[model samples]
Target: MIQAPGKLADATVPHIITELPGPKARAQIEFDKQWTSPSVPRAYPVVPVRGEGCTIEDIDGNLLLDFNAGIAVTSTGHCHPDVVRRIQDQAAQLIHYSADFYLPIYAETCAELARIAPMTEKCRVFLSNSGTEAVEGAIKLARFATKRPYLVAFLGAFHGRTYGSVSLTASKAKYHAGFGPMLPGIFHAPFGHVADLKWFDEVLFDRLVPADEVAAIIVEPIQGEGGYIVPEDGFMQGLRKICDKNGILLIADEVQAGAGRTGKMWSIQNWDVEPDILVTAKGIASGMPLSAFVARDSLMTKWGPGAHGTTYGGNPLACAASLETIKLLEGGLMDNARVRGEELMAGLRAVQAKFPSVIKDVRGIGLMIGVEFDSHERAAAVEWGCFQRGVLVLEAGHTVIRVSPPLVITEDEVVIGLKLFGEAVAEAATKV
Candidate 1:
């Protein structure tokens, strides 16, 4: 077993040493704004120079609590010791071994994935550089394996920004505004409403596409970017039955919700429903670029290798980091998510109680949570307020403040975050 990384977590964090965006940060932000793409949606400026565990030291010399976790990528927290050492060790040994050839580290990473797979039967692992690539690859695999022509996704799911994955994405109309004809034959189902699988058979199949021609039905176990909306148990169970009846592969896009973020190796495991293809990333490699789409070995054998491949999908350094990350998650972070999740939820509920007019709901499992505000303006205000106070956070959907901190965050840190968050909520509530 690989050793767990030093948590590096501090309880009394957000040690602000300067103004929100001090002189250095202001200049850098201006520089970045001039050079970087306009499409990047930076919530609030906290220019990070270095990070450790649950805290970030900004370029302006202010230390802020990191609740965003680099958009839920740093599962083992920032610069985890074990993950860093493994990555350093692997980089010295080998940096860019082409994925075209075999690598021991790659095999080890895949093996660990197989061991933790939600599938009951033997599974195969395919590595990719990011979550979008995983979804894209799985899309191709689902179509090829099923020999079907159509795919179905949920209304509020944010799959990715790429053509094919973005085609399946329906979180915002702007995503498809000019993208024109999204890959054809993809259907969208109202997410939380379709608890019974029959909705697909009756409404979608009857009026729109034929269910039999569908290749797969991809879903985020707990919707992430669109909002941290957790579907009811019956909804997930019904989804499985629908897929079974329609000969459609079930794809769980656990990109933002996996890697023990939801207290499970795969978020779908919470529903006790296994997907035909499980696409996961975000927190997989502690910060290194890595994602894997694990599927039944039987289904994967369909691909004749060259049919699909990537240049840096299984880079040795990423593999090493992933291996260490899995060990760290298994060691204790998974349970930590579960335990801390309850504490966080209870705390958030208290905030909601205090400002019922502002907060609509507090929902999610483990550390993957969303606090729905009555209006997007209020949500934005609260997000900015938290940022000003040096506690990092992000917004999702239209009116939700997402609280997805690293799993290693301690109870005291949770208390501090909630205290700051509550203050922000109270202020937002009072706003006209």
Candidate 2:
């Protein structure tokens, strides 16, 4: 196991030293308010100065247990020595080289991914800077390879904020409000509801876009921003069958649920279903700005030279970090996610038993757990309570609390964090 950095080795977690939004943090927030775009969302105003493992220290010297993990991006924890060492070593050697040209680290990263890719056949990867870019690439590849113009995505799915990705995203109306005339030939279906899946065949394909014209069906193995909803058994299998029968591509949007976040290397692996294309980011590079869409060699080969590319998609530094991140995941972090996830879910269920009225649902796979409240207001209150207690969490969909800590979180940390979370829920329940 990688050792903690010296500075964090002795720091007590969930350590609150001053009032939240402390002087320093307030100043930063004010300055950010003036300079940063208002479109960006802010959960709680705990300005972090540094982080190690699952602990984040704010400018006021208050230590908070980070359960959000930067929205599930830090799979291996903060400043993992192995990942940091790789970044440092790679930065010293080479930082940026156009991925358009060959780079050893780039090739190594893709090779490593091929080993763990969900496809049984040989897979090829298209690297990009973020999840949205990966999705955009997948869109293009799917259309080009299949020669189809139509696409299908689930309602409440968040692919990205870029033009094409935003067009595909249906999580919130505000995302596409005034964006208007989103790319044509895209359809939305209900997520995780079997009736909606049936509607696709009996209604959508029959009355709307024909199945032959559809290029791909993009879906999150476990919806992230939607509600961390895990679909019922056979849901994925049914989708795979549909795609196979129609010659349509299955695009698994594993951006938030992949990279060991769901206990497996990829969330789709849990269902034993192989997607035609897998788009991933978030935790792929242990917080580095990198994403990739992997596809079977046959599909990837159809894309001609210069069909699609990015300038910094496969930066050497990011690739090196990814190599180390994958090593850490395969080494032991995935197992930790599985074991700790079960323990965390059991604790959440117990908390739900205490406040059944407040918590409507609790569901997840591995560490990507969610606790749904009866109302958005109650969920927000619980979020605030957790923040006051120095446990950082994030709200999902309309009334769900996402609990996606770094995969490296220990059993002791899980116990402490959940205790605070339970207390927060109890307090929020009283308010409702």
Return the top candidate by TM-score. 2
Q: Residue pairs in steric clash, candidate 1?
A: none
lDDT of each: 0.88, 0.91
Q: Taking the tens digit of each residue's C-alpha lDDT, what string does model 2 give over 1-432?
A: 533535763666788878886889999998989999898988878798898889898888888999999999999998898899999999999999888888989999998888899999999998888999999999999999999999999988999988888998888888899889898889888888655579778877999988999999999989999888999888898899889999999999999999998889999999899999999898999889999999999999997779998899988988988999999999889999999999999999999999998999999999999999999999999999999999999999999999999999988889999999999998998886
Local distance difference test, candidate 2: 0.91
Candidate 2 residue 76 C-alpha distance from true site, Å: 0.5
**TM-scores for every predicted model:** 0.97, 0.98
lDDT of 1 by residue, 120-228 (tens): 9899899999888999999999999999999999989999988999999988898889779888988888887454466797888898888789999999989999989
Provide the lDDT at 348 for model 1.
98
What is the Å distance of residue 311 in model 2 from its true position? 0.7
Model 1 regions more than 4 Å off: 1-11, 194-196
